[model samples]
Target: MTRSRAQTRLMLAILGAVFAFLYVPISVLFALSFNEGGLPTAWTGFSTKWYGELLRNADIMGAAWNSLIVAVASTVIATVLGTLLAIGIEMRRRKGRLVETLVFAPMIIPDIVLAIALLSMFSLAGVRMGLHTIIVSHVVFNLAFVCAVVRARLRSFDWSIVEASTDLGAPATVTLRRVILPSLLPAVIAGALLAFTLSIDEFIIAFFTAGAGRSSITLPMQIFAMIRFGVTPEINALATIVMTLSLVMLAISQRLNRGSLPGQ
Candidate 1:
């Protein structure tokens, strides 16, 4: 009985320590966001002044708008292409390893390498680097994510039903429209949400691809520039808001997926 009690105590102690380690920093950050004096070292009661300042800051709003455009465009492109790619690849009886590798290449490749490669390609082709370039770059990686996510949804997909529809004189278009797409809807939306979150938060690629102007800057780029000037109360408010948006999107994606093993 004593040994069991000691083990329970030890387990609780370890879990308690882990929880504190994970959350203490977040707790501090949340507290600092509301600090009236705009200083982390000392709290001078709660205030929403920093958030108000963030709203009134035109430069910040410009960057935020740019990010929204990039994220929205990328997500839309990725969702369409990724859904189609998933269907095409899964329809085959034997999946090609080469095709799989090509689709997933962006996920594993170093971001710096992709960034430099895109820059070199654009420079050679005389494609002006700006918000459009950022959108194109985001689409490249975002498409990979959407494809992978939608592919997972297809693994356990009942192709026999599709065959049955076709065997009943349903055209390929009909099978896709009535049979395939409805089943993939959940994953399609999940992938789009995931892609949007990634594009919104992506910094390194956006920073490199955003050309030589503050005009085309994204929110992450703005945040990076702000951080270089040191921490401020307004920054805390901005960070809190961004983090909340990301967390909410993540929760939605998780809810869409039951996390079954692919093909199981």
Candidate 2:
């Protein structure tokens, strides 16, 4: 009994340490976001002034709007194309390893490599890098995630219902709308949210594809530019807001997925 008690205590200690390692820095940053002095070393009471300043900052707001546009456009395109692609892939009786690898390549590829490749492709193709290009680039990677999420939901999906609808004289479009899509809606929404968060946070790809312009700057890019100038109170506030948004989206995605995401 003493030995078992000691083991349990050690396990609890390890768990506590792991939690602290993961969250202590984030907790400190969160606390400093509200610090009136805005310094990590010193706390001069709490304030929400930085958040107000963030809202009033035109450059930040513009970049935020640009990020929103990219995220929304990419999510929408990825969701539709990805859902169809997932359905088509899942319908195949014999899935090949090559096909699977190709489909999942975007998810596994290094961001820097992908960004450089995209930049080269665009340059060779004479495609002007702008918001449209960013949306297109984002869609390429986002679709893989959306497809994976939709495919996970499809694992337990019933094909018979779709067959029955077809036998009952329903059109393919009607069956998809009334039967297949309704069942896949939860995963679809979750995938969209996930894609939105990723696109919003993606920096390297957007930076490479954004080309020469202040017009296409995104929130992540804006944050990077600010950090280069030196960390400010506004950065803490911006970081907090961005992190909170990401957490909220992730929480919603997990809730909607009911714990069954792509890999799990």
- TM, every model: 0.92, 0.95
Clash count, candidate 1: 0
Which residue pairs show collisions in model 2?
A: none
Choose the strongest candidate by lDDT.
Answer: 2
The regions of model 1 sitting more than 4 angstroms off are: 1-19, 259-264
Candidate 2 displacement at residue 36 in angstroms: 1.0
Clash count, candidate 2: 0
Model 2: how far residue 124 lies from native, Å: 0.7
Predicted candidate 1 versus true structure: per-residue lDDT over 181-201, tens digit per residue: 898888888888999999999
Q: Which ranges in model 2 have alpha carbons more than 4 Å from their true place?
A: 259-264
Clashing pairs in 1: none
lDDT of 1: 0.88
* lDDT (Cα atoms) of all candidates against the true structure: 0.88, 0.92
